[model samples]
Target chain A: MDDRRVAVVVEDDEDIRELMVALLGQSGFEVHAAANGTDGVDAVKENDPVLVTVDLGLPDIDGYEVTRRVRRFTDAYVVMLTARNEEIDTLMGLDAGADDYLTKPFRPRELRARVEAMLRRPRVAQAPVGTQAPIPTSVPAVPEHGQGDTAGQAAGPTSAAAGSAAAAPSGPAGRTDGSSADARLVLNGLVLYPHVHHVEAEGRDVTLTPTEFVLLETLLRSGRVVRSKAELTRILRGDEPDAGTFVSESDERTVEVHVGNMRRKLGDDPRRPRWIETVRGIGYRAAGAAETSG
Target chain B: MTTAPVIDTDALGRLGEQLGDPEVLCGFIRRYEKMLGQRVERLHHALNTQDHDDWMDAVLSLKTSSAMAGAAALSQLAAELQDYLAKRPPDPVRWPVTDCLESVMAKLRHLARETARQLRLFLNRLSASPQLA
Candidate 1:
C-alpha cells in the first residue's frame, strides 16, 4: 500500500535495463526489470506500473509488438527505446501505443526527467466522477536501505539534482519556453493544442492520451503538407535544436499508425481518408476534403 | 528532395490569373469549407465542454486555418483566441467568440456559394493573411 508509482524497464540488454532500473529507483520509484517482451508484458500486468520504458529491439518479441500488446490491457505511460535512431521506429512505437519515444545512448538523467514530467500531468480521474474507488493495487515502496539508485533523483541531494540540471540543456530533449507559447491546430472538425497537449472534435471534447494529441496536432499544424519522418520525430521528441544524436530518416509508417488513430477518432475511413490523406512514398497530408467532411 | 509547389504570391497570383477562373475560387471555396467549418466546430466543442486545454487546442488550430483561408476577421479572431489561451491560466473573458466565430462561418459560407465571387477582393480585404509571396 505504498502508493508510490512503480516503473517497469524492459530490455534484453542487461546493462541498459539495469541502468534504467537504477535510474528510476533512485528517483524513489519501485522498479521492475524484464529481459524480454513476454516477461515485460507479464510484469506490467502483475505490477501495474504507472510507467514502463521498453527497448524496441527485444530478443523474442520486438518492442513495437510488445507496445501494441500492452495497449490491449493497460494504459501505463510507455516510452520506447530505440537503438538505431530510425524515425520509422519512433513512429511505430507511437502508433503501437507508446506514450513517448527515446533513442538509445540517451542520458540516464533524461530518462528520470521524462518519468517525472509524465507524472506531473494531472491525470483525469479514470474512474467515472465519484463512484466507488476501484480496488487498490499494491504499490511497493523502495526499501530505505536499498542502494540501487543513481545520483539524479528529482528531489534528491542538491549536487545530484544540479548535475541533471546542467545536463538538461545539452541533452537531446526539447524544452518548451513560455515565449513560444501554446500551439493551436484546426483540421476537419478537430482542434489541437500543442502547448497544453489537448484535443477536441466536433464540439465534443475528445479524450486523447497525451501522445495522441501531440501527434495529431503536429500533423494538423503542418497543414496538408506531408512531414518527413525525421521532421515529425524531431517535433515529437523535442530534441534540442543543436543536439547531435544520429537520426535515421527512413521509415515513416509509425506516423501512419498515429494518423490512422487520428482518422478513427475523427470518423475518417482508413482505406479512404476524408481527414488525413495518405501521401504515397513520402508521408501523410491533411487533405481539405478530410478536414470538412464532418 | 522533391520541392513542393511554391505557395508564394508570385506562384499563387500567377496560378490564379492563369487558371483563370472558376477553379481558383472553387478551390478556395472547397478549402475554406473544410478549414473554417472544422475550426468553428472545434471551437464550439472546446467552449461547450469548458475544457480549457481543448479550447486552446481548437483556437490554435483556427489561428492557422483562418490565415490559410483568407478569413482575415476570423484569422485575427483565432489569433487573438490563441494568444489569450496561450497565456498560462487563461482568461475566458477575452475570447472574441460572438463576432469572430459567427463572421468566419458566414464568410466561409459566402465564399463557398460560388466558384468565383471577387476572389481578389476576398483575399486582399482580409487582414490576417499568411506570409504571401
Candidate 2:
C-alpha cells in the first residue's frame, strides 16, 4: 500500500478540477476529484485525504456545508475556492471550518505553494480506526509575553517536538523554524499534538480547524517574538503570494478574522488573554515560551 | 464584420496547461455545448413562469460556465446581467450592463447566440492548428 499523502479536489468545473488534480499530483499526493458537495464530502470520508480544496458554488450543496460536514469527522487541511468579489464567501468558508480560501483564477503555482506551506506544520498520529479521539481539553490562559523563558525551555526544543511519542522526557515537540515534525508540544497544561493536529488546554482537547491549528502553532513556536500581521498573513497565504496577490491590509483582515474565531474556540478572553497576547499596532505573540529556540 | 473575439484561444490554452492537455478543453466545450441548451431551456421556462429565482439560476450558471470556458465577453455580460438583476438598483453601478431585466435577458439571448457561433469558429480554428490538434 502506498503511504503517500492523499488530496481531494471538490470542484464543479471539469477544467478546474483537472487543474487541481494535476497540481496535487506534482506535490506527491494521490489525488481524487469530485463534481459536487455531496460527492466531495463522500470522497473525503472514503480517502481520508490530508488536504482538500472545495469550490463555493457547488451544485448539490454549498461549500460551507461541505466543509462543516468534513470537519465533523476529519482534520484535513481544507482550502476553499472563492471568487474575488465575494468577501463573505471567504469569511464564511473559514468559519465553516476551512483552513484557507484560494481566490478563483489563481495561479496554479500559488495553489502548490500554499499546499506546501500547509503541509509544513506537521501532523499527529490518528486515533485507531472507528474510535473517536478523546474530547478536547479546555484552553488554558496563555502566559504573559517575555516572562516565560523557563516555561519555554522546560517545554524542550527541537527533539521534543519532533518525536511523536508523548511518552518522551519532555513535553510535546514543536520547532520554531517549522522544520521538525515531532508528535506533541506541551506548554505547561497547553498541549499541541502536531501529529494529529490536536490541541489541549487545561487537560481538555480543543477542536481547532486546520487553519486555526496552524496559526496557534505558529504563534506558540514563536513565543515572545512579536510576529507581525504581514508575517502571519504570509504564513496563512503560504510563502509567496507577496507581490502579485493583494496588499497586506487585506491579508491583515484574514488573519484578524481567523484569530478572532480561534480565540472564541479556545475561549480565551481577549481583554485578559491567558494564552495569546495582543500588541497594539503590531501583531500577536503567544504569551508562553519566551525563550523559544525551536 | 470585424468583431473582437468572444472566446480567447489563449485563455483556452491556459486552461489546457492547467489540465495538462487539450483534451479537457475540447471535452468541456462539448459538454458546455450540451449544457447550454438545457440552461437556455431553463431561461425560457423562467420567462414563461415569471420565476425570478429560476431566471437568476440560469443567468448565474451561464455566467460561471462561460467564465470557466474563458468566454470573456459572454462571461462579463452574463455576470453583469446577473448582478444587475440581483441588485435591481436605479442605476448600473458595479458593471456596465443595462438595469432592465428584459434588456439584460435580451442581451443574454444575443450573447448566447453569438457565443455559440464563436464557439463553432473556435472549434474550427483548434482543428486547423496542428499543435492543438
Candidate 3:
C-alpha cells in the first residue's frame, strides 16, 4: 500500500503551480497539480489528498466554489492562496470551507510552517463508529462522570448535568487515559463520538468539517465553560491552549469564522443558539439544554 | 537608464533553502522565465481591450509569480499598476486612462524583460557554482 501523504495544488499560474508542486514534493507529499478550478476539483476527487492549496482566482470556477465542492466528499485541509491580502478574502475562504489562507508573495518558510502545523493536527477517521472492530470487555469502561479537572462539569439546569455525564476530555488538555477515546458526549440532544469523528443531533447525523468537529467536541466537553477566542485559536493551531503561543488577532478572527460556519451548519442560531452560544466579549460556550429548550 | 536590481537574490536563496533542493529552485526559475512573456502579453491585451476582469487576473498573476521568483522590482511594479487600475475612475473624467496606461505598459514591458534576464543569469550562476548546486 502507498502510505505516502498526498497534496494537491490548485493554481492557475504555471509558475506558482510548479513552485507549489516542487515545495510540496520536497515536503514528502505526493503532489498533484491543476491549473484551473475544474481540473482542481477533479484532481482532488481522484487523489483524495490530505492537503490542498487553492488559488482564489482561477480561469473557470473560483476557489470558493471548488472548496465547497471538495468539502462534500472529503475533509482535506485546504489552504487558499490569494494575491490580495484583504480580510474579506480570508473570511470568504474560511466560510467556503478552507482551513487556512496565505496571501501571495508569502514567505516560503511561512508556508512550510503553516503546512506543518496543519498536518500535525489529527484528521477525522472516515469510517463510521459501528463498523469498527469491537473493544475487548477487559478494557476498563470510560467513567460516566469523569473525575479529571478537565472533565465536563455539570452546569446549567438538570438537562445540562445529564449531558455532562457523557462528556469526554476535550482535545489534549484533559485526556489522561486512552479510555476517553471511547467516550460519547451528549449536549442538548447533540451526540459526539470523539473516537470515530461522528456526530448526531436528535438522531440525525451531522456532517462537520474536521475543524468544526474539533471545535464542537471541545465546546461539548467544556460544558458551560467559556472558551476564549485566543484559546480556541491555539487549539485550532494544534497547540495546547495555554502553550504560551502568541495568538494574533487574525488567528482569533479565523476561529470566529470557523465557529460561525459551524453554527450555521449545526442550525444553531447565534441569537438563540441551541448548542453553541457566544458569550460576547469572551468567546463561545455550549448552550445548556434547558436554556435552549424554550 | 540602468534599472534597480530586478531580482532579490536573498529571497531566491531563502526559497531555495525552503525547497531544500537547488535543482527545484532552478526549475522554478526556468518556468518563471518561460511564462513571463505570455503573462505580459496577456496584461497588454487585457489593458488594450479594457477588460477589467482579465486585467486584474493578468496583473495579479504577474505580481504573484514575480514575487515568488524573487523578481522584486517587477512584482512591485505590478502591484502599483494593480492599485492604479483599481482606483481609476470608470468615466476617466479627471485622468486619461489610456495616456497613463501607455506609460505604465512600457514600464511593465521593460521590467518583465529585465526580470527574465536576471533570473536566467541567476540560474547560470547556480548551475556553475558547485557549492550552490
Going through the candidates in order, state the TM-score of chain A alone for each one. Answer: 0.53, 0.69, 0.78
Report the lDDT tens digits of candidate 3 across residue range B1-104. 33436998988888887777888888888999999989999998988887787888898988888888888888888887788777876554233278777887
Q: What are the clashing pairs of model 3?
A: none
**Candidate 3, residues A111-165: lDDT per residue as tens digits?**
8889987765544333222334343232121212222111111111211111112
Q: How many backbone clashes does candidate 2 have?
A: 27
Candidate 1: residue A132 lDDT (0-100): 38
Candidate 2 lDDT over residue span A1-294, tens digit each: 234578899987665677577668877888999999999989987877778899887778988888877776566678898754567767877888887778766665678877875665343333332323342233122211232111111111211222222312221123433322233555656777544455667765566765677678778877777777777766554443232445457668788888988887677888998788888798898877833222
Candidate 1 lDDT at A61 equals 90
User: Which regions in candidate 3 have their CA more than 4 angstroms from the true location?
Assistant: A128-183, A195-206, A289-294, B1-4, B88-96, B130-133
| Candidate 2 Cα deviation (angstroms), residue B132 | 5.8
How much lDDT does candidate 3 score?
Answer: 0.73
Q: What share of the true interface contacts does candidate 3 keep?
A: 0.76
Candidate 1 accuracy as TM-score: 0.39
Candidate that would win on DockQ? 3
Candidate 3's error at B31, in angstroms? 1.1
DockQ for each candidate? 0.01, 0.27, 0.66
